[model samples]
Target: MIKYIDSYDFFACQLDNQRCRLLALPWEDVLVAHILPRLPLMQLFDLQRVSKRFRALIRLFFTKRTTFELVGHHVPKVAFFSLVKDNNVLRKLLLESCSSWLTDNDLLPVVSRNPRLQTLDLSGCNGLTRHALVAVSLTCVHLRHLAVARCDFVDGPSLRSLADHCGELRSLDLSGCCRLTDATICYLAKKCVRLTFLSLAVNENITDESVEDVAKNCRGLEHLDLTCCLRVRDVSIRTVAEYCPKLQSLKVKHCHHVTESSLEPLRKRKVLIDVHPPPRRDRLSLAVDCGPYVNIQPLSARLLPSGLNADPLRAHMNGPAKVSDPWKNHPSFPPVMPHLQSPSHLLTLHPSCLVLALRCSSSPSLWSL
Candidate 1:
């Protein structure tokens, strides 16, 4: 009975050893196809030092991966090259954060390899020059969305090269590229007619001509940012309002000449603008001219059309329209002061009081009769 029990125990030990030796799936297939691919790019570097087999598997994994995004990673030049050297099938390469050290030599090789790239975001890559831009334009013709924002080294000729080659570009962000001028923008507008999202923000060189050209040519433009473009005026805004029917959002912040007159049409169309429309100068001028003696009404009633009488206060409100004596005509209207009948009484008030009264007119409660 003791010998039989020893044999059974020995058989059980052998079975357990066999089970441990044989995996459910092959190790190579499991690591290369499943595990390595799932691991983050940075972790793969640590995993590569595990063994020769792991290093080979990581290389194989990168060769099959379609997207490589390492935003804000302080990747060394050598490490960046090593990670991307094996990756040739990349469709989207986003390395915005590595802008500090990323150079033409490091980027050109990757751009050359990945001809099928659809989106490339290298925003803030000030280290790169027009050579990098030219290389990307000439090589990655399939690019649709490209963001080189704050890459001030990019010049007009490289952009022209990009526009010429990548005509199918849909979204392009050139914000903070101070070297770009109106001519570059015009050429881009003419070539990239399929653009739906564009930004020329922070470039003071951008003027009404370029903006108007973009509005007319890129009618499909949905999102446009012209922030800090001081030269962009009301004319270009009006042109945009007329031409860009599909425009969804517009950013004209810091545009001094772009007033409510041009933006009113866009407002009516429900297009979202980053800057709030300035108060109508006409209304404020009229208010100031009327002086402190006039009875102030709700701003809404003052802006109402001559035919529209929706405001209940319209009957009592002392507005701009020349009306007969309301006290005699409408019994409900309050009695008129002596100053209401004569305009000369307004000029008698001190200049400081007039200024204070104008400021107070903004609030109905603070207004003096």
Candidate 2:
């Protein structure tokens, strides 16, 4: 009996050595991650092939390694936190750990194991909609910088959850989250009052009402990017001017409604056009007026009904309109202002004339593209 036991012990010792060698491989990061989890399930199925002591050591290392991975970075470190599919085994593990990291309401799991995590970059994690943000805000309380530019799941429930829970949030980048609307803006304003830097680029749903709410709540806001927010008319900028007193840098490109007057609030507006915006006295709708140099006929022609614009055109059939009527058969009309016929013709002179207009209504000093 003693001889048999010794033989078994020697075989177990050799098995432990082989398993350790696999774990020690340093050539691939991917290999370590793959093998770590399997150690648990592998022991349950194939431990007999290796010594009992070797199996116990592998399980111990697996637990320790996972804990290390979770708490590894805390400084300016960046990480990707995403939800796995329902069928994924890891997803089941994550779900089981769902204990509220920040709130008392839900027993959701908070990912606060890392004290040094600063930048939580979830740029393209499609599965992690608003449902997951609440937990993050609670767990990552030290998180000052966050980028969720394309996640669309952040609707009302999760957004409001953040404001109520994560009041420390400062900078947020929601550049391409198109589904977010006025309600989300209001929640952020009312909850996360510390938001200093924000980017709403290409968010098609945000309008003047949303801007007003943000201005009211986030008074400390400094830098704002309103690029591609098409509905942001003069009203939106006007609100920002009245509310966001500390604003410094702004991007209003493609905001056609922006005008020199709209820019009266900002100290320095970043305009991406070569030509200097027209004077305030000649300001258009909010920022684009047809005065300082804009032609009169095209302005009235399109803004006015075709019936009215046709009146002067039809009237000329009797005899003539005037030398200034560029469309008439006047002698000097074509050479003087060659492209001065229809509103479309005037717009051909300057493409910025589409129903779209943008301006830096934040304030005004020097403007550039």
RMSD for each of the candidates: 12.1, 17.5
Model 2 CA RMSD to the hidden true structure, in angstroms: 17.5
- Which numbered prediction scores highest in lDDT against the true structure? 1
Window of ten residues with lowest summed lDDT in model 1:
349-358
lDDT of 2: 0.54
Runs of candidate 2 exceeding 4 Å displacement: 1-110, 267-369
Over all chains combined, what TM-score does candidate 2 have? 0.46
C-alpha TM-score for every candidate: 0.70, 0.46
Tens digit of per-residue lDDT, candidate 2, span 43-100: 3234434665545544444333422222222311111122111111111122211211
- lDDT for each residue of candidate 1 in 189-268, tens digit (9 for 90 to 100): 99999999999999999999999999999999999999999999999999999899999999999899899889888888
After superposing candidate 1 on the true structure, give the runs of residues whose Cα lies further than 4 Å from its correct spot. Answer: 1-38, 278-369
Q: List the global CA lDDT of all models.
A: 0.77, 0.54
Candidate 1, clashing residue pairs? none
